[model samples]
Target: MARASRVAALAIAVLFLCGCGTVANLETGYRQGWKNAVIYGGVRRDVQSAGQWIDHSWTWGKDLDIIQDIGTVVGVGLVGIDIPLSAVGDTLTLPVTVPIAIYNNSTNRASVSRKTDAAPPAAAVPVNEK
Candidate 1:
């Protein structure tokens, strides 16, 4: 009975080690999300600044980003892919995300420019005014 208990304990230990390794991938996904927040923020600004004449091209890029994020989360957190696969996925998806990030950034920049252009100039104060 003692031997059986020892064997069972060993089996449990081995299984725990194997299974828990994948759980770390959840952290990997979260870290990626935090790292990409700037890109997401630009996308948000694009959404907020969209003009009636603008066709909202950022929507497509935003959808792509969301799809990629969901895929990464599911792949790493739910499917329990290896930790290294997280890096592999990031590498593979860079090409996909980079353009979207750039597009979003440019959109935000243009929006800022338009706001600046539309702003009323400051009133000039008379030098002799008290």
Candidate 2:
């Protein structure tokens, strides 16, 4: 019985350390945090700087991305002891997902190049023909 319980506890801990908490936090509260920062917090230089640091320019998407990433790190750190691994995986997913989210979430929904979009767009006309 004692060994069985210990195994169960270890399993739980491993699950917690797999970044589930970070992904949950991201899915649940990110939009609210973003709205609060942009709407209530307003434009502060510090906020803008953090925004630029994450996404390379001070658009709202970038600003909210900083908040999102920080929350992911802190949330996963609190819940997961193996934060280095979890943070690494979470960080990787964001840059790829976030840019696509920004592009798709826009009113225009225009197509944009993504880091993993790998395929180069076809030329309007073949170079040999031109």
Candidate 3:
């Protein structure tokens, strides 16, 4: 039992250290999980991507071999484990991440507005007479 527990812990640590969706979200301004107040955005995003992959595999990969099928199943299983883990990470760090996401959004909007405001209006083109 202790061995099993230790193995599980090590697996989780490896997954966490390998940079899952939560890490990617942090690096990308938390864009994946910022929509939800509870911060399940990262999981949702990961699921969507996984769903797309599965959908594409079924739709486009009509002749997958045994090895390919096994690989897909394993990939999906890993994602299954990753989704909840990412959700937990996002939830745990919500206090810090939410504020950072808000700041990034605000700054992005402000910069866009500034650029638009600074741009001059286009002048009318003159008509060419024969």
Best by TM-score: 3
Residue-by-residue lDDT tens digits, candidate 1, 1-130: 9999999998666444433222233334347752343322322322333331132322455347655555445444423433333334334445555675676678779888887756678889867856
Residue 50, model 3: lDDT of 71
Instruction: Name model 1 segments beyond 4 Å from true.
Output: 1-83, 117-130
Report the error of model 3 at residue 110, Å: 2.0
lDDT of 3 by residue, 28-130 (tens): 5535554333345567667776776666555445467654676578558648777777877778768876776687678779888887746577888988999
> Which prediction has more favorable lDDT, 2 or 3?
3
Whole-model Cα lDDT per candidate? 0.46, 0.46, 0.67
Give model 1's TM-score versus the native structure. 0.29
| Model 1 lDDT at residue 88 | 43
Give lDDT: candidate 1, residue 128: 86
Model 2 local distance difference test score = 0.46
Candidate 3 residues lying further than 4 Å off, grouped into runs, are: 1-19, 28-41, 60-63, 117-130
lDDT of 2 by residue, 47-71 (tens): 3333444443234553476676675
